[model samples]
Target: MAYVIDGDKCDAKITWLPVSGSLKTGELVELIQLVEEDDKLSREALALKDIFNDIIEEGLTYPQLGYHDESRFKSYYLSHAAFALRLANSGKVIGGFYIKPNFPGRCSHICNAGFIVDMAWRGKGAGRFMAEQYKLLAPELGYRASMFNLVFVSNQGSIHLWESLGFKKIGVVPQAGNLKGIGYQDALQFYFSFVKE
Candidate 1:
């Protein structure tokens, strides 16, 4: 059955709440490992020749936002600047998210985020849940806007959902994504504004 889940108790948009929690630091390592695994969710790693592969080899289509070198990705998480969230029910993590300040100085008010759900959990509203949480959480974390830098234009589900949540298409990079078999495709940029409440 369809249910309603709000960013907080205030904004009453209804969806579903399948999970909740701030991902632990230790769990960040676990997510990195999973992201690098040679599986469906690991598409970001498909271009990598090694765990420590060069970013250029992966092509621009790759969602490397989460797969940066050990020093970079970890520094963001360790510095308490980037945060990851996991969807959990009854003590198990089912899905996850990575979010952080988009810039260092004046642009700190803007944040960026990425999400992933267990393939087994896809089509179950987990993505929606996490997004709703972000709407609420971003402001709480001192962010004014949450930007999605490189959304695949073909990812209709996400495009539709983000629009429903009031995110706007701000720009597009022509032929910025390398689609396997299909060659390159445009990368759509999106912005979601989160105001103080």
Candidate 2:
């Protein structure tokens, strides 16, 4: 089961300034937060669902074994602060992420986030762009730190991205993921702090 944050504990208002930049592929993209009432929610969600399902089918990044239906997608990705990366010209949703408290009550200050980039856009710097935005936005949402609970060790791109962004590998859970074809693989836990001690 996925981790769920208590509604009362994490009341941080989620909002951010949209940012635009060019990808390595030379496409300009804009990062915008997705609110429930936004007119683009349905359309964006449809595209994102396909991208998310493709990743899940690959069994490399996310842990979900089966495809995510609309309800499941909303509950998992849209429960809290969500953002999407869209082409500046076409407004096509190519990637997105969600942020929520890793735990409830006293631990609510520490946030956890999940990200997905459309397969076609992979390796073109979309992931890095989203990670950079996440670093800025997480703190703005009142999170003091961020943690990724189950990053598969085989995911070199993600491992590199997190490390380059100053997220420290705090621990590793052996045989944490029963990935497709590869069987069980270790998962790495990463943490980054917004507040310096």
Candidate 3:
């Protein structure tokens, strides 16, 4: 049930999965819309509030993302999508995730990733499956470790999922994220090492 994905630099040890009865699909069009909507909320609320709306409108694309021409949004998701996974069922996109080097130059050895699952498909072990894939894929892409920069304190499910996967708590930035109606909340950072030294 598991396969390894190897990249140019290392043996990923990742299990990149394909649609195989892991889930059932409803409407393909609706699924994409659901992913977009959830992405909009996360970008606007629990993420950087500066260009929240713009990022939502422009989306995580390359060259042109909303009104801005350049952003980590494009660089990570659009540029480094080679090390990624697209989860679907019945030709409908259930989830997608991407892993990128967390920084440039000296910090390029470390990586970061983001996963988004359609709202309707949540609570069905989709995220857990994707997270496991990313952890393995990251190492093969020449990364020694992986990091989740900002996890909203209110998102108990995600916090629990990452922690259960052996990712450690690096630090917390209090009242750093705005949850729309909920004002501001703490953002937690998590890290996982492929090779523990």
Candidate 4:
């Protein structure tokens, strides 16, 4: 399926949700689209960049090595339809993701996405919440399926999250990730179809 509308056109409003199993009541988070026109070094963008770079430094999840400057981060994450999650009251960016066609032309019906949650905010359901939003927003962007090419085997939380969301492990890439301190590790490829076939 071709894009119903450009990814940047898909938008969502600020939403407040209670932290699952927490006594702190509800927290407000605003999901905002990231566009090329946004300042590359804006406060929100910089916060997201820090989180992303932290993940990259962990060397177990994403493939990129070293650090990403503002320009590089924006080029990679904001080049397509991207979104950022922030505390509505504090305006602190806590998480974000990017969606883009997995392949060219006819195969573009399938999209690939990358996600990151602030280390401080993990386990509070932000990742899962963003994932659930992705399930809804991706189809609206005209994608029929979502595919993750390299979910590291050691990343059990991510693997479990994807599976819990109804994504299937379609294949494994042997030694797909050359991680720091861990040497080579296998990677799982996950797929989820939005259309019933």
Local distance difference test scores for all models: 0.53, 0.87, 0.55, 0.80
Q: How would you encode candidate 4's per-residue C-alpha lDDT over 143-192 as one tens digit per residue?
A: 89999999999999999999999999999999999998899999999999
TM-score of each predicted structure versus truth = 0.60, 0.93, 0.64, 0.85
Report the C-alpha displacement of residue 54, candidate 4, in angstroms: 1.1
- Model 2: how far residue 165 lies from native, Å: 0.7
Off by over 4 Å in 1: 1-62, 65-90
Off by over 4 Å in 4: 1-25
If both were scored by lDDT, which would come out higher, candidate 2 or candidate 4? Answer: 2
Q: Which model, 2 or 3, shows the larger TM-score? A: 2
Runs of candidate 3 with Cα error greater than 4 angstroms are 1-76, 82-89
Clashing pairs in 4: none
Candidate 2, which segments miss by more than 4 Å at Cα?
Answer: 8-16, 38-41
Ranking by lDDT: 2, 4, 3, 1
Quickly count the clashes in candidate 1.
Answer: 4
Better of 2 and 3 by lDDT: 2
User: Which residue pairs of candidate 1 clash?
Assistant: 4-14, 4-15, 5-15, 61-178
RMSD of 2: 2.1
